[model samples]
Target: MLAAIRSIIFIPVFYGGSTPIIILAFLVALFSESGTHFMGRLWSRYHYLCARLILGIRVKIEGEIRNEPLLYVFKHESMFETIDLLRIFKKPVVIAKKELLVIPLWGWIAKRHGLLGIDRDGGGAAMRQIIKQARKAVAQGRPIIIFAEGSRAHHGQRPELQTGFAGIYKLMELPLVPVALDSGLVAPRDTFVQKSGVITYAVQDEIEPGLGRDDIRDRVHAAINALND
Candidate 1:
């Protein structure tokens, strides 16, 4: 009860105070890519802090992330996992839905931070765009992180893996790191209420770049299920 109350009260104050700061941070991110990376890191630090202060939830990470220009296929459980990645990796180039880029200030900030937006309905063309943008990001020496499921999963169920990732794996021909997150549904979806709990992130084995697309997807799915079990 106390936790719920604290979370409820903290929402308004937290967002009210953080909005301006986020805008200022976004502006700083727009001018320079390096600055965007730095600000992204800074935003993640503050985001964790705010989550703790408001919801009493903590984040824990397991496994080591390899330092190389590669692709990270992560499980999309909730928005938390997305924010958490800012702290886990360096200068990550995220693949997100294009709709998010339409959001007012937040979308603008995401664009500045080097996020790659995809039109889910663009079919094969979307994959081509991803490959084009991903090549550029990888060339800059940043690991590209894609939520292979493409969107958040339903409560108590694993999300269906999307096939677009296969194109990325085949085109980029870089190492693919499988990432899994546990307990992200604590916050649920379409609601601001947060349930107090610990969310765990695990980085599993690297799938060598040469593997067939199906092989890579199978490996990543198995890794994610291991976490669920």
Candidate 2:
């Protein structure tokens, strides 16, 4: 019942309170992409505060965040870490669903802010296209970020890395840094009944570029699931 009460208050507080900030972000995008990123970071910071104050959720980081440009791979366990990584990694050019690029205002701004959207149905051709886009992002001095599994999974779900991970890693020629997080423990998918808990982000060491596909995949898979282990 107490959990229910917290979720009830938090559901509205998290969404309603964030609406204004998002609206402000749309306006900020009209002027400067950098200003838009500042707003995005602000938006993420606001949620962190809300998650802590209203839902009793805390975030713990287990490793260092680098400042250099490279490939950042993350575990996608819930929606919490999706945008939260913005503040965590400062500002990375995220590889997200192509559909996100169609979401009215947010999509347009996201593209301008350097989001690389991928169409999941384009098969090998899609992977090639994403690699092409990633190259441009790298040239612009931005690190490429992606969710290893491509989509969220239930708590304890250890799905293998998506097919594109290997293609991009090999072609991008950027060191791979895997980040693991346990957000589903508290901010689970498809529900608002959040519990008080620590959502831990485990950043593993960097794997050098040019590793073989099988070798890199195994290393990244293990690293990103470190928190689960």
List the global CA lDDT of all models: 0.78, 0.85
Top candidate, metric TM-score: 2
| lDDT tens digits, residue span 6-96, model 1 | 7678677767766777877777865777887787777777777888877877877788886468888888778877887887777888998
- For model 1 the local lDDT of residue 223 reads 82
lDDT of 1 at 95: 90
Candidate 2 on 133-209: residue-level lDDT in tens?
87887887777899979889887889988887888898899988999889988888888788899999888999999
Task: Tell me the spans in candidate 1 whose CA falls farther than 4 Å from its real position.
Answer: 154-156
Tell me the TM-score of each prediction against the true structure.
0.91, 0.93
TM-score of 1: 0.91
